[model samples]
Target: MLLKPITPCLWYDGQAKEAADYYVSIFPNSKITSVQKFNDSHKAVTDQDTGSVLTVAFELNGQPFVGLNGGPHFKFNEAVSFTIQCKDQAEIDYYWDKLGEGGDESKQRCGWLSDRFGVSWQVVPAALVELMVSSDPEKAKKTTAAMLQMKKFDIAALKAAGDS
Candidate 1:
């Protein structure tokens, strides 16, 4: 398939294929688009084995992304993150648990967590955004406050807080 106009590229030390497969497994509407291996001509520049994975193109929930085995010079940080907007509690739970597995719980806060590869992700309820932008400023404030204190968002709790 042709690439998207703009695709987010994830740099990995050497787990590009592994990360792509794991992400594909987690999201129901996702798949690996393509995989490229380092060739003899490129091996000298990349310092990778000729047959090692060079890049992996994948889709997560329909969003296209590329994962590159670009060595350890760069690392993922909180500055870049993917947010999954969930319609309900079940969706939120599924994402939070799956993405948070093998991650540092302490580093997680306010619906944000890092995967095993240290890629930051936010599993949030769709309602939270609506609540935060509601016409009632008080409701928005309450919901925002409630969300600020959560590691994994509880949609019911946020709604209750907004109502109160």
Candidate 2:
């Protein structure tokens, strides 16, 4: 049973365990909690060999997720993404670099990146929303403009733009 009532499950062709391990390594207070394997009963339904990884249950920063070793009939796309609201530039940089490693460079824009697993992530400063929604219309516009130009968020630059 998952610790959370609703958990996001990622579908991978045969890299469920690998993906789970990679994710857990990046986030603090994260770990692979359980692993399920396919058995003879599932032979008729799945191409995976018996004893192969079926699903990996893991947690990243207390958020529960499952990686299913489903066949590659589906793929992850920009339609869905996980947002990491970082407290500072350092946090932003850490997550940006860590998750963006081995990712597709062409997909990076406005603090969004697509990792090696084809998972999309938005690594933005926690203060970005406030800056973008400021009472001052010019500040909000400038902040938004500044944000649009960067792949990885520069909090100081954003703040400067908001202040200007």
Candidate 3:
């Protein structure tokens, strides 16, 4: 299949297909669209096996992305992350747990975590944003402080802070 014109490409050493599969399994409205494999004709260019996955095009919650098995020359870092806006605490907990599975716990904080594939993700609650940007400065400040101390966001906590 042809690549999407403006899809975000995720670089992985050799886990493109695995990541794509995992992502599609967890996210609603997500699926693997296509997989391109490396061939012998391109053996000299990449370290992957001739028939191994070269790239996988997938969508998570309708957002398109491409996972590339582009060797270890590059790595994922905290600079880029996908933000999943969840409706409530249950949704936040689900994504936080799923994305943080086998991930670096020490590096996770404030609604951000790195997945097992080294991809950073932000599992944020939709209500938190409004609270954090509320017209009342005290509410916003309280929400911000509450958020800073959390790994997985608690919508109840956030609402309480805003109320306080």
Best by lDDT: 2
- What is the overall TM-score of model 1 with all chains considered together? 0.94
The estimated TM-scores of all candidates read 0.94, 0.96, 0.94
Relative to the true structure, candidate 3 reaches a TM of 0.94
What's the distance in Å from true for residue 109, model 1? Answer: 1.0
Positional deviation of residue 29's Cα in model 2 after best superposition, in angstroms = 0.6
Residues 1-164, candidate 3: write the lDDT tens digits. 66567889999999999999999999999999999899998877766678899999999888899999988899999999989889887899899999899998987999999999999999998766687998889889988999899988888888898898
Q: What is the lDDT of residue 4 in candidate 3?
A: 61
**lDDT tens readout by residue for model 2, 1-164:** 64678899999999999999999999999999999999999989877899999999999999999999889799999999999999998999999999999999999999999999999999988887887998889999999999999989998999898898
Instruction: Estimate, for each residue in 1-164, the C-alpha lDDT of model 1 and write its tens digit.
Output: 58889999999999999999999999989999999999999955878998899999999989999999999999998999999989899999999999899987877999999999999999988876687777899998998999899889888898899999
- Scanning candidate 3 in windows of ten residues, the lowest lDDT window is 41-50
lDDT of candidates 1 onward, in order: 0.92, 0.92, 0.89
**Ranking 1 against 2 by TM-score, winner:** 2
Worst 10 residues of 1 by lDDT: 125-134
> What are the clashing pairs of model 1?
none
Error at 89, model 3, angstroms: 0.9
Model with the higher lDDT, candidate 1 or 2 = 2
| Model 1, C-alpha of 61: deviation from truth (Å) | 2.1
